[model samples]
Target: MAGVVTGDDVRITRKVQQLGSSTLAVTLPAEWAREHEVEKGDSVVVQRDESSGSLLVVPDRTLVEDAETTVDASGLDADALGRAVVAQYVLGRRLVHVVDDGPIAPAHRDAVLDAERGLMGVGIVEETTEAMTLRCSIAADDFELPTLLGRLDRTETTMRDDALAAFLDGDAERARAVEQRHAQVDKLFYLLLRVLFATYRNPDLNRAVGVDTGFPLIGYRSVAQDVVLMADAATDLAALTGEPIPATAREHLTGLEDAIDDAADAARNAVVDPSYADVTRAREALDRARNRTDAANESLERERPEPLLRLQRAVCALSGDTRHVRDTLDVATRLTFRDGSGATPE
Candidate 1:
């Protein structure tokens, strides 16, 4: 039977004790059971280990008729998936698995692989299978977890706003400013990573969550890198010294920009409302934009030294921005589910 001991306050000691039967036993402190209103007749759950000859006892969970329990999403959407992985890292869940029902796309898989290198103690275990597992030994917590996500969001926003403004205003100074801002974002990203890894090393949080959360952490880092790269490319386009962007190129760039914005907006709905409809629509739009950009790039290559090469290179680079934007939406979508939205909770 488990019991508690009292000092200045009722307390419990969790440990292992040796038994003569080649086993280890832990006694519950008497004061604890009394304080908890536990009686001799009350049932308790005891977990036994044959390998180590150990036993773990607790108040019998089965005895409770209506216990409050939170449901874990065994299956996750993009947004929810990212947050879970991040939470796992913050909680020090090191061995994270992001398994899908079908085979993942090569691009998506590559993105995850890149994330593994960018994040601490993160790596891809099985990329070719129906479900992929990412492993990382990191700790995540409520306090700093949101902050890390927030910093990444801010980085994307800053880059997009700066680059877009520079392009519109035709200002070299603005382009330089946008580039300079990257340094700040980079610094914050590093700091967030440091905090995440530091939490992983802490015994308490690490023990609580385990390694499963690393996939999300790595995923988030990957998104941040994508955003940074996208923004940098956009800023470069804005700084390009070409004949005022051609009418066709300008129109195409504008369309791509609008599509990127739409994708981000669609993701917002998924994050806030979590309807599959919204995610589906966003995915479709993103796919179309990617295809259009590819076609535009090909056409430009064929018409080179004539009119579109300069614009094409600049615009193609901006495709990276769109992809990162999509990932950001995915991140946001993951967060909405965590806030207690069943299908898009609030």
Candidate 2:
């Protein structure tokens, strides 16, 4: 039997008594057992916490259940109602009830619908004058973290490419499509956040998804956020310059674009296959990209069109985002290869 430590650090001492020739036993504290609603012959799970070297005695009756929360949205505006619903979803609530004692305002109902559209697996299953019910249809096992990350990466890459092409070709329709696709990126990101939060809270879920022991959850979350930010930067870039880019400015922008792409590739490699060498290469690439962006900005004439200025700023933002990604990979690499002295591997 394992020792139990209470929150007050009070250690419960028990003697190991021989029950028979082959059996030994330790009695549990009545108070503790009663608190957990343990009864005679009830099943319990005993597992060792590898990190803390503590034995955990968990009641097997603590079943994983779908959680529900009701938000009293009485008199709340549309934005507030939307934020409240999103908060519940992010908190891992499977079902959310947005209720008003009186008739639900049309604006408030629209807000709930908007929130559902923005999030993944969330939908309004039922709505009435007094209440609206939002359900998360996605199961924890529906998708794995690695697959989500891969999809996010691919989606963002496509968005970036399309945005660039739209800008260069002056395709207003394609630009609108790129903007619309950002919503898709947002969906994947929100879903990934939900999964990451769940895995962070439950070790079983973490292990089930095969998260690397050396890779911190926060690091993965940061990478996912960085990917989204890159997509946002692409969207911003695509929004500028509906007119065809001038040949002169386009040449400079293309160099900056290529540099950003190279830096992104290096950062992705460092994160997916972490090593000191990969991180170092990513850092170097980002540095070169930064210098190139500065040179490109200088090459643009001071009297250039407003759209070109916006494009220049967008390129700079993309460079900044790529640097952020490289920095995240740098931290991930250090965490994965820390020495006994806590120093990163050379």
Candidate 3:
């Protein structure tokens, strides 16, 4: 006997039986059947899932209401209101209202506008003097975690590469562009957060989000944060473009940059599709990056009294920020042992 699928904390076990020479059937619970308005002659829709070898029965279409909440922004400041809006979005709220007893302050209104622009798939549907409504039109199946993670990886890689080029080439315009492009990565990160958090709250959405409920979901969250940290480090490198960069500093950092370029790409791939071979490749590249960063840092201490003084702080900050890429190796190692299991519902 196998347990039938239903809501949490309840299980209905059933045994398969023969109907006719070439047919099989299982009796549905009378209580469940009556609740769904299904009768003996009713034709319930049956969907067969090839991957899990499971059949889904739908007696009728049920309309699910969107989840919503109302936030009273009476005395909250701009920063407070902004945080509130983001909090609701991450909690899977589909509709949010920022209301006050009377007309909301100008600063609070601007804060809501900024929050809406920052979040993905969230827009203002209606606005009045006293209240503003934000509507999130995204679904669980809208974007898979793997695909979203890939997009983040690509964007961060491009930004880092451009920022590094601007740093080493002393290109001011390109540096500005790199800094500006950082926002896109943040947007992707937030969207990923929404999906991951929502999926966590509703384990049934595992298939819809394209990541399993337990370990795979946690790994994606960690990897996404690491990528964002790398982007921040890259932006730091960009900011140093017009700084008084010493020749020795640039020469020392070049090796580290090269190592990270390979290490980050390899590590991201391994996290997304983990295997022994990919994990080994990522580990090797990360080792190279670590060694290079250590050497780069040591060079500053061994230099003359003020040789790297002007560039020491920027170099240290950039190196430390980018080192977060090393954390992804742990995730890759753990996932490699998962044997590609739990990728789909059972």
- The lDDT values for all models are 0.56, 0.73, 0.77
For each candidate, what TM-score against the reference? 0.47, 0.77, 0.76
Candidates 1 and 3, the one with greater TM-score: 3
Candidate 1 weakest ten by summed lDDT = 62-71
lDDT of 1 by residue, 31-101 (tens): 65665456878876554432355544556431221111121334554445455554554344446565555
- How many collisions per candidate? 31, 0, 0
Off by over 4 Å in 2: 1-66, 212-215, 301-308, 338-346
Candidate 2: minimum summed lDDT over ten consecutive residues — where?
A: 334-343
Ranking by TM-score: 2, 3, 1
lDDT of 1 at 88: 51
Q: What is the C-alpha RMSD of each candidate to the true structure, in Å?
A: 17.3, 6.0, 7.3
Q: Mind giving the per-residue lDDT tens digits that candidate 3 earns over 119-174?
A: 88999999999999999998766999989999999998888778877766678999
The weakest ten consecutive residues by lDDT in model 3 span 57-66
Top candidate (TM-score): 2
TM-score, candidate number 2: 0.77
Q: Model 1 reaches what TM-score against the true structure?
A: 0.47
Q: Candidate order by lDDT, highest to lowest? A: 3, 2, 1
